[model samples]
Target: MLLANLMAFMLFGFDKRRAVRGMARIRERTLLLWALAGGGGGAPGAFAARRLFRHKTRKRPFVRWLWLIAAAQALVLAGWAMI
Candidate 1:
C-alpha cells in the first residue's frame, strides 16, 4: 500500500509537470489503476496535489472516478475491519 501510494504520488507529480509543459499526459486509466490497486489511500494527497498544481481537478470524469475509487476502497476496508 505504501509503495503504491508513493508511486501514485510520483505519477501525479509527473503528470502535472507534463500538463504545465504542454507535453504528453499520463493516461487516466493508469492513474486510476494505481489508485484501485491500493493507492486509493493516497487519493487525498493526489487531490491536494491536483489543487496545488492546478491539474486535472476540473475534469469531471477524473474527479468522479477518483471519488468512486476512494469510496469503494473505504467500503472494502470497513468490511474487512468488520470481519
Candidate 2:
C-alpha cells in the first residue's frame, strides 16, 4: 500500500508534468489502477497527489472514477469490519 501510493503519486505528478510539456500523456486507466491500488491499501495518497499536483481536476470522468474507487473501498472496509 505504501509502495502503491508512492507509485501513484509519482505517476500523477509525472502525468501532470507531461501534460504541461505537451508530451504523450499517461493512460487514464493506468492512473486509475494505481489510484485504486493505493486506495485499496487504505491510502488516499494518489488523490492527495491529485490535489497537490493539480492533475485531472477538470476531468469529470476521472474524478467520478476516483469517487467510485473510494466508495468501493469504503464498502469493502465496512464489510470486512462486519466479518
Candidate 3:
C-alpha cells in the first residue's frame, strides 16, 4: 500500500510531457490493480495527476469509474481489516 501510494505520488508529481501516453487502458487497469492490492489512495492520486497534468482526464468514463470503485474498495477492505 505504501509502495502504491509512492508510485501514485510519483505518477502525479511527474510532468505530463514525461508521462507515457497511448497506454490509457493499460495504465488505468494497472492503477485498478494497485488499488485492489491495498493501494486505495492510488486511484485518487491518479485522478489528481490527470487533472493537474490535464492528460486523459476526459478520455474514458469506464476507467474513471474503475479508479473510483477501486478506491472505495480499498477503503472498505482497510476498514474490514482494521476490525
- Model 2 regions more than 4 Å off: none
Q: Residue by residue across 1-83, what tens digits does model 3's lDDT show?
A: 66765665455444355555533333555655543454344565555656676765655774667566765867777998999
Q: What ordering of candidates by lDDT runs from best to worst?
A: 2, 1, 3
TM-score of 2: 0.87
How would you encode candidate 1's per-residue C-alpha lDDT over 1-83 as one tens digit per residue?
77667777778889999988999999999887776775336665566666677777789999899899888888888988899
Better model by lDDT: candidate 1 vs candidate 2: 2
- Where does model 3 exceed 4 Å of error? 12-15, 18-26, 39-41, 74-78
How much is the lDDT of residue 58 in candidate 2?
92
List the pairs of residues colliding in candidate 3. none
Which regions of candidate 1 are displaced past 4 Å? 39-42
- Superposed on all Cα atoms, the candidates' RMSDs to the truth, in angstroms, are 1.9, 1.9, 4.3
Ranking by TM-score: 2, 1, 3
lDDT of the structure predicted as candidate 3: 0.58
Candidate 2 or 1, higher TM-score: 2
Model 3 poorest 10 in a row by lDDT: 17-26
